[model samples]
Target: MTTVKVKLTHKNYDVKIEKGLHQAIGEQVRSVWQPRKVVLITDSNVGPLYLSSAQGQLEKAGFEVLPVEVPAGEASKSLTKVGEIISQMAQAGFTRQDGVISLGGGMVGDLSGVVASLYMRGIAFIQIATSLTAQVDSSVGGKTAVNLGETKNIAGTFYQPDLVLVDSDYLDTLTDRDLVEGYGEVAKTSALEGQDFFNFTGKIRSVQDIRDHAPELSERSIAYKAKVVMGDEKEAGQRQFLNFGHTFGHAIELLSHGSLRHGEAVAIGMVTVTRVFEAEGISPEGLTQALIDRLQAVGLPISSDLVGTPLFFQHMINDKKNRGGVINMVALAQVGQPIIVPKPLDEIRSMI
Candidate 1:
């Protein structure tokens, strides 16, 4: 078991990473939260697989578990779904002291976090991350949000979880593509952390290989992200490095009309941004190709056909990271070194 502590000004929580911890979640929750009406939110794909074990454990531990399942995909991260979850919690008489449990991947964690944040002003929440993307990225950070229209995570908050339970066993049910989708995040984190992580992931070629090394890979990734979150809880400074591939990634997500997965979009985003930076002579030469080789080795896209299109242009302009008519894209100084470069919209567009 690897326990990483995330210390913020408002609260501090532990990210518990252990294989097969899913069956013991009830006892774990009991340790941190008192018995209460705990609402567990999951998605279609995950609910049938592990929901019963998680819910049964919580119920056995005396928590009033209210299990809810959303459609499986990025579409569920919206105000409409959040309203439905809130309505259910309200009807069940949940209150400020009640807790929420996110029992699936990134969308589940993000939506559940926001619901917990808004319900009765605020409520305690726990993350039982079932996907690599959630365990390593979304679940650790205090960033909880619901996408609004074409904007991803446009409506959200920096609300920390009371506990994060990451059990790598959940990866067993994932399809090959699902595992590959997560490697994009693994790639991003490795790039920002250092060359050691970069090389570790570079050698992994298959999604099954990624799953084979889940526990250690997840523990390492979570710790790096936790360290960043601890230092910049609100994304005011150092935390932005965590968005290494996100600037253009979010735009790619919007332009895909929900076809591309988040991590996959970020994979191409990392490549796109690296290529742009290398062309501008800001990044060291071969940085783009080096990054591309690893991403492609894991079956992630290294470029997009929409890069110079009009829709891509519009979404990049509307990116959430933009401020005062300038956009900030995280560029790689090398495999493990990241730098944030702020540029005008036109300058960014010309690179694409």
Candidate 2:
């Protein structure tokens, strides 16, 4: 098992990475969560696979476990779903004293965390991430949210989980499409960390390959992300760099109408940013081609012809990173180092 401690200004928590930690969720979160009730939340897909084990573990640890299931997929991540879950918890007599156990991939983790934060002001939660995307990104950052009307994660909060347990075993159940989604975040972090790490990820082939590289990949991703998040937990400044591929990615995703997974969209978005910046002489020459090659090596999407529309740019203006009509686009000076480039919405629209 490997443990990385995230040190925030007001709170700190450990992101524990192990192969079988999902089976021990009750014991793992025991220290931080002394709960009157443990509300275990999972998505429809993952609930059947791991919920019972988590429930049994928590029950064995003497927690009164309550299970909640949300339909799987990005569409389930909505204000409506959040409201439903909150209402269910209220009916169950849950209070802030009862913690939440998020036991699935990114969607489940995001939805569960949102419910935990909103139920009775806020409550403790522990994330047992079952997907590569969640394990590497969403599970650790404490950035929780649900989509609002085609915009992704437009409503969320930064309420840290008590602890994070990442079990690589879950990657075994992912389909090729799901595998590609995981690589999206892996590629994003690799780009942000610099050329060597970016190149390192290019060699990975499948979920099993990722498992072999988990120690190195997970550590580097978490380190770069944690550094930025600790410096700016609320996205007030440096944290925006983690959005290196997110601004445009979000727009393309909305345009795709849930056809493209978040990471798939990010893959295209990163390529888009690289090309646009390179054309404007902001990034190095051939950067887009280089990213395309690496992204292709990992089976990620390089471009989306469907993203060519005025609606795409409209969504950019609505991005959370924009302020005062200026979009805070995260540009790579090269791979690894990021610079926030603010441009008027008109310039961004014209560039797109």
What is the number of backbone collisions in each predicted candidate, taken in the order shown? 0, 1
Question: What value does the lDDT take at residue 288 in candidate 1?
Answer: 80
Residues 1-352 of candidate 1: C-alpha lDDT, one tens digit per residue: 8899988888999999888899899999999998999999999999999899999999999999999999998889999999999999999999888999999999999999999999989999999999888877889988899988877788998889999999988988888778788889988888889889888987887777798888878888988998888888888898889888888888887888867888889999888888888988888898788778888887888777877788887887667788977987788887767788998988876777
Per-candidate TM-score against the hidden true structure: 0.98, 0.96
For model 1 the local lDDT of residue 5 reads 90
- Judged by whole-model lDDT over C-alpha atoms, candidate 2 comes out at 0.83
